[model samples]
Target: MSAPAAPASRADWPEIRTGIAADVHAFAVDDPGPLRLADLDWAGAPRLSGHSDGDAALHAICDALLSAAGLGDMGEHFGVDRPEHAGRRSADFLAATLRMVRDAGWSVMHVAVQVVTRRPRIAPRRREAEARLTELVGAPVSFAATTTDGLGALGEGDGLLAQAVATLVRPGDPARPA
Candidate 1:
């Protein structure tokens, strides 16, 4: 075979200061009762249980973004016992998260989320879910789904789990080396 191409140097990469955060959230369906999975928006899908809409995906995403910006977590900002957030929607959470991140001098660059569930197959509506989340966050959002292969509670179809990673960047910050 011909010689392999050399890897690009660090200088070749874009000059930007970026931060990353990841979070995971899992809830048993029986804990909080039947609540909707906001992203899926499918009527037949098994609902999650939580104080809000219980969209694990959105909640995880918000947590990740907040963590990345050193802004604490979802529970601290929107506590379970807070009556004001009793029946809030995941979309509202997302909006508030974006605003908080912006106020902290960071902008969301990208978001990726993976949800694990055994019901209402995600492939059919994956695109719709991604688009909706993107609109809410004003950033590109990627969505994925998986099953536990009958291994654990998720595998046994008891609940859903979601994990998210967020990339944030601070622009025009002199502290960041160009």
Candidate 2:
């Protein structure tokens, strides 16, 4: 191999920024209904609680994207304390973040997320989550599912964890999206 490929020239690539985020929240255990719950899950399944849909994964991913783009965190824009967003959709928040990212002179090149749960395994709905992220980021989004393996508070049965990474691209020539 004569020098392999030397990777690619950054001079030709758009400027990019990246950020990481992680979060965990306790399960509701109070909601009456079940969502895709099955016996294969941990001993018990508790509903998640939050102002929005309570999807820690989505929330964390959105925060990562906003942070990478220099936008404010979720609470500053849509916090539980604000009654106006008492029951809004988390997707909306991500969408707003996407717009803000673009407005702030950046584009979401990609995002990756991991949703950790002992019960109601995340493997099943991972694709759906990726699709939702794609819609917001205006590009391909990747997702992964993992378990604490009885290692953390989440594994101990207190709650779940959501971690995310967002990679943003600064336009090479400030081209507008069509």
Query: Which candidate should be chosen as best, given TM-score against the real structure?
Result: 1
Which residue runs does candidate 1 get wrong by more than 4 Å?
1-35, 38-40, 175-178
Task: Tell me the TM-score of model 2.
Answer: 0.78
- Over 26-144, each residue of candidate 1 has an lDDT whose tens digit, in order, gives 44444534545535456555456678877888898888888888888888999988989986888788889889999988878898888887875788888988998888888999989
Off by over 4 Å in 2: 1-13, 33-44, 173-178
| Residue 13, candidate 1: C-alpha displacement in angstroms | 11
Instruction: State each model's C-alpha RMSD to the native.
Output: 5.4, 5.8
What lDDT does candidate 1 reach at residue 82?
93
In candidate 2, what are the lDDT values of residues 16-89, reduced to their tens digit?
89978886778877774332111112324665677766667667877898888778788887888998877556
Predict model 1's lDDT versus the native: 0.75
Clashes of each: 0, 1
Task: Output the lDDT of residue 79, model 2.
Answer: 84
